[model samples]
Target: MGTKGQLVTDPRAAALASKAWPYEEARKLLKRYPEGKPARNGQPAPIIFETGYGPSGLPHIGTFNEVLRTTMVRHAFQAMSDAPTRLIEFSDDMDGLRKVPDNVPNQAMLTEHLGKPLSRIPDPFGKFESFAAHNNAMLRDFLDRFGFDYEFISSASQYEAGVFDDALKGVLRHYDAIMGVMLPTLRKERAATYSPILPISPKTGIVLQVPVEVVDADLGTIRFTDSDGEVLTQSVLGGQAKLQWKVDWAMRWVALGVDYEMYGKDLIDSGVQSGKIARVLGGRPPEALIYEMFLDENGEKISKSKGNGLTLEQWLDYGTQESLAFFAYREPKKAKQLHIGVIPRAVDEYFQFRGNYAAQPLEQKLGNPAHHIHNGAVPAANPPVTFGLLLNLVGVLGAGATPAQVRGYLANYVDGEITPELDALIDHALAYNRDFVAPTLVRRKPQGVEVAALERLDRELAPLPAETSAVDLQNIVYAIGNDGGFENLRDWFGALYETLLGSSQGPRMGSFIALYGIDNSRKLIAEALAR
Candidate 1:
């Protein structure tokens, strides 16, 4: 078991723990390969694969998630390892473009490039080589911005050149047996109307199977040729692809030289196949780490190209990148809800992970300078403020708040980057939108003080110290509480809440006074009472 943000010590804990993250997922991976069995000399390399989707449109959050999961697992191995390792993000741009996303305003521009591999799609914006190239390039940029290391291999390039020839042959060699298992299982489990491998035409909704034969299967690949014996395409050779997805998967574990891989429970039958294939094909299958599917909070899988999908880029533009990272990761074999509304809790969790742990392998990977700065290795010389503050600042500045806007309104003199803090606060404020009927949700009331408590606060402010600071303000709140009236002097609670929250139940009143400056504190209270 592990604490929140702690390295998981057991696999079952992956499914049981609250606030699950990368650690539990890592522990689950470890369980697949016991501590000392088949004791090899050193750590085996993990064969990590992100089934890169055809990126004909802007990539959605889930695609990023596929790679992100791989990245997280990669880090776990790195964190657990004594040396460096690598992971790859393979894109199936060779696959035909599926559909146009709503976010992209120009639908017509994408129509001409439908049947070809996404990489060959012409860039509508005329910025990249092709449509697939344009979308994937942006997505890759987005991923790289977050510090993911991926060696990208385009299926367009691979297939056209017959890179998987041997693997395709293997698939042909075992095609009948492979279909024997998959066809029945899929029919019984899912009401799937289509085969796992489609033979449909892109232009029309019709199935067509011309014909192809295995030309070769060697050098870790499978090659395909037309019935006329003209080389057509190639994949990793061997009945490898035919080994039932599970068996094929097991074969992947061996052929790809993968040490760890995770999938959804929806693929359980395939997982069963991977195990069978591992035994049939010799050696061990890669770790079978399963994660739950993510549905919108309302309960539907987030779909790409439907405009209904939540994207990582969209999430990051609004919330911090780290916030997106923490939320994207999870463990278990069920469905989890991920939507914009959960941003705050996710942000809060990320911060807590940073403040409470040594960051590396806990909060983030070590040696990332930006992550260090973000976590506050650079001491905060000024008083702390929330992200809500910065967001507000952005709004204000847009409406013409300047550095000098500092003294114009809400004017009090405490140091720090006021504008930035204001922006953070405003951004933080929008998080409550989850509870709203519209896109924008504002915090209702400032965190409340009682009339008597207000008076007490007033009286405390009378005898001002030469050096009023947060501590001094706190003392005043405490003093008022210590000497009070009636049934328990609600002044204490008010002071507590009002002090930190500005209405009380927050920081010490004295400290609040000091941190926010006496003027701002007094002004805020007065305005609150007036309202």
Candidate 2:
């Protein structure tokens, strides 16, 4: 692969990168699924994966990220094999409502349907099957726009279509062990926080606890008691439908043929319980990839019920799909502050990889990692635009303005003539708009300039070509950074502000100029100076 300078020259690290760890993880999971079994045909069955788009709120980026991570690996496999790999994105719509999600039209629906199943809600979109359909539609739209390939399997569809009939019967046969394990799972108190889970009948409202024996296999009948001995009712209550999480985890690996699965760090319990279920029920747990949590702009883990998640729709306004893809590929290893701010870096790295990919020749492996992250290859880059202008352009464009409209508004102050180099930039913008909603806010107005430096800037820059080199521009900007009676580094900081951002402090000025077009950079800073 190619790099900004020379190839990395290290064979071992290159080898390590060639088979991305995530892909390996997926392969390991295959061994645990029925598809992993040796066969004459040697063709693997489809892998069924699950995700819950809770109605507690609009599905956010974290929601999409979880699903996308699975899709990413799925793509890796598809790329490598002539064979088919099926992935199913499941919705937990048949479950009951624990709380109301933000932005949903009906708040009263929660109490009105208090004990009713989530699958029974009326469709808000008026076209979908039910309330769950509207919420799922938003998620589906995002997944499709972002290019995720997955089969949509809803709880309503699974039950109504009777996909769980056999599994349900198996669950009844193991009902005793299910109750034996779940009842004590609660009351870990003082040390562990357990929210007492119990299954109840929706029609009877009878708490189905103790010997969760054959509840009505049909006509909706079943109940389970929580730690508080309160009965909870659910229409779809059975081993398969209401399989105590651990057993359910194992069963899916067997039933749907999921080979690989990844979960957040906080879900250790689910992972542990699923491991147990695998041994007892399906006889094997899916391959596990534990991911780290995603923090907000303020470094807080995003929570849907808590109204803290920033949806994928919002992040798209400031970033591209490739940027988002790269972000997912890189993160989930450690917790880092997240916000619209992370987009630029992801975009830059993606472009760097693309540049390298274009210049280098390498073998394509279906199960191999993207490897570009380690190959020192430069990714395709979206030509640089002024950050301020980008923010503004996206600001208006993000508000559902068409690309043509965005182009018209951008033409007003983007004084320089358009260049073919920026075609990539336009494409990135289009993808961002087509994928996500506008962010609630942009990065703190990219980190403020000095009047003395500003005054010198106009003259300093006047001699340059309308389209100048970023480095050349930055060099000129810093050459005079020590102006205006300055004696120390602090004094020169103003120059960085003037040339790079029209502020006294900002990103590394040279790096900033290199990424942002010189002309647009000048225009933005000049306007800021005029203020």
Q: Which candidate tops TM-score?
A: 2
lDDT for each candidate structure: 0.50, 0.55
What is the TM-score of each predicted model, taking all chains together?
A: 0.66, 0.70
Worst 10 residues of 1 by lDDT: 434-443
- Residue-by-residue lDDT tens digits, candidate 2, 470-530: 5676677666665555576565664444333333235555444434434555665566555
The residue-by-residue lDDT of candidate 1 on 399-435, one tens digit each, is 3334344333224434544556444434443433222
Which regions of candidate 2 deviate over 4 angstroms?
Answer: 1-19, 30-36, 39-44, 47-52, 79-83, 124-127, 188-211, 214-241, 360-381, 384-471, 481-494, 498-531
TM-score of 1: 0.66
Which candidate gets the maximum lDDT versus the true structure?
A: 2
